[model samples]
Target: MKILVAGATGKTGIRLVKRLAAGGHTPVALVRKSSDTSSLPDQTQLRVGDLADLPAGVCDGCDVVIFAAGSGGDTGADMTDKIDRDGAMALIDQAAESGVARFVMLSSVGADDPDSKSDLAHYLQAKHDADEYLKASGLTYAIVRPVSLTDDDGTGDVILGRDVDPHAKAARGDVARVLADAVSSDDWGGKTRLMQTA
Candidate 1:
């Protein structure tokens, strides 16, 4: 399978890239020029550009596009909107245009609950909006909403379903692996899975 790995520099993103390659799939690392690409698996192909700068046929021959890019920090909600909301939406449109068969979005767990009024509500809202867009995009898609991320090791066993469990926090590596598996899972096709620990 040809896979597009957006935000390939992030913690989970890098793991996903490596895991995808090791799984015998070709992963195209999509990253902005400013992102550090050294940590990515050497076998991964790179597409260097911002989310808004995707070229025509950028995702050509790619079976799946995994959106792992995110903007979170002291940069405020506007940046979140630009990268998380608009950027994600833009990628979805491009993937659709490129005829990519599947899209797997790495969204947050709280994204679906409209009543979620956390300090990072903007981030959640952005993911929510993106999730809806993917659902309506008329394409095969899977949205994986994982809870508070930990840098802990992956066990290769995870619970994946409709919402993140309140009592669990997920390891970043585990999430990445799950997303990769989702791309290949017939049961996960066109499904939005929320993942957390058992």
Candidate 2:
């Protein structure tokens, strides 16, 4: 399957690309003109475009899409709305329009219930909105929502549910592995999962 990755330069996104390729699937890295490709795998297929306005046929002929893009904490809510929410929605729309079969989202843990005590409420709200949109978009979908991300090496073991501990944390590598699986299989489709290290 041709998997189009939106956040190809991100920590998990890079890993997802590698994971997909290693699993014998073609991964298309959607990158911008100024994106840093230093960490990307060699000879990666590139689709140059911004999330704000993707080019025509950006998702054409692709089998599935994984939206792992986000605006960092340094940015404001507006950027989050654009990248996390609007940009993700754009991909969902384009994927469906272009005949893509499945859509998977790399969402946050608390998107189902944003933590009011943290500064991530807006971001989570955006994720929740996008997740809801995908659920209603009539596309085979899965929302891989992972809790606070860590730099620890993956254990490939995780707890998945909405009732998980709020403080649960997951390694980006593990999350990437799950995302790769979610894209390639439908065992967890029609479900929005919250994942964390077991």
Candidate 3:
């Protein structure tokens, strides 16, 4: 399988790229020019571009497109919508245009609740919008709404299902591994699965 990984420089993206390549699948590293991808495996292909500026043919011959991009820590709703919601939508458009087969999104747990009173509600709303768009796009998609991310060691075990617990959280590595599994699974096709710790 040929996979395109957006946000390839992120903590989770790096792990996803290495594992995909190690599994003998072709991995495309989609990153902004300013991001550091020096740690990515040598076999991984590099594509320098942001989701908003994804080049024509960026998704060429790709089987799966993993969306891991975001405007990190931004409180502004407009920025959240632009980079998270609109950016994800843009990638889906390009993927469809390029005939990509499946799309997987690394979203957050509370994203399904647009009216949540959390401080990050705007960010969650952006992800919610993006997830909805992907679900309605008629493309094979799996949206993984992971809980609070921790840098702690991974448990290797994850709770994978729809309707996550309100107080759930998981290690970042665990979340990424689940995402990799979701992308490679036939079972998750066209399904929105949430992830949480045991």
For residue 41, give model 3's deviation from the true position in Å.
1.0
Question: Model 1 — TM-score against the truth?
Answer: 0.94
Model 1 misplaced regions, further than 4 Å? 162-164
Q: Where is model 3 more than 4 Å wrong at Cα?
A: 162-164
Q: For candidate 3, write residues 1-198 as lDDT tens digits.
A: 999998777888887788788889899998888888789999888887776666777888899999987788844777777789998998988888888788999998777776677788788888998999998888888898887877654888888875557577777778778778878689888887778877
lDDT values, one for every candidate: 0.84, 0.87, 0.83
When superposed on Cα atoms, how far off is each prediction in RMSD?
1.6, 1.4, 1.6
State how far residue 20 of model 3 sits from its true place (Å): 0.9
In model 2, how large is the Cα lDDT of residue 116? Answer: 71
What's the TM-score of each model vs. the native?
0.94, 0.94, 0.93
Best-fitting candidate, measured by lDDT?
Answer: 2
- How many angstroms is residue 78 displaced in model 1 relative to the true structure, after the best TM-score fit? 1.1
User: What value of lDDT does candidate 1 attain over all alpha carbons?
Assistant: 0.84
Indicate whether candidate 2 or candidate 3 has the larger TM-score: 2
Per-candidate clashes come to 1, 0, 0
137, model 1: CA deviation in Å?
Answer: 0.3
Q: Ten consecutive residues with minimal summed lDDT in candidate 1? A: 51-60
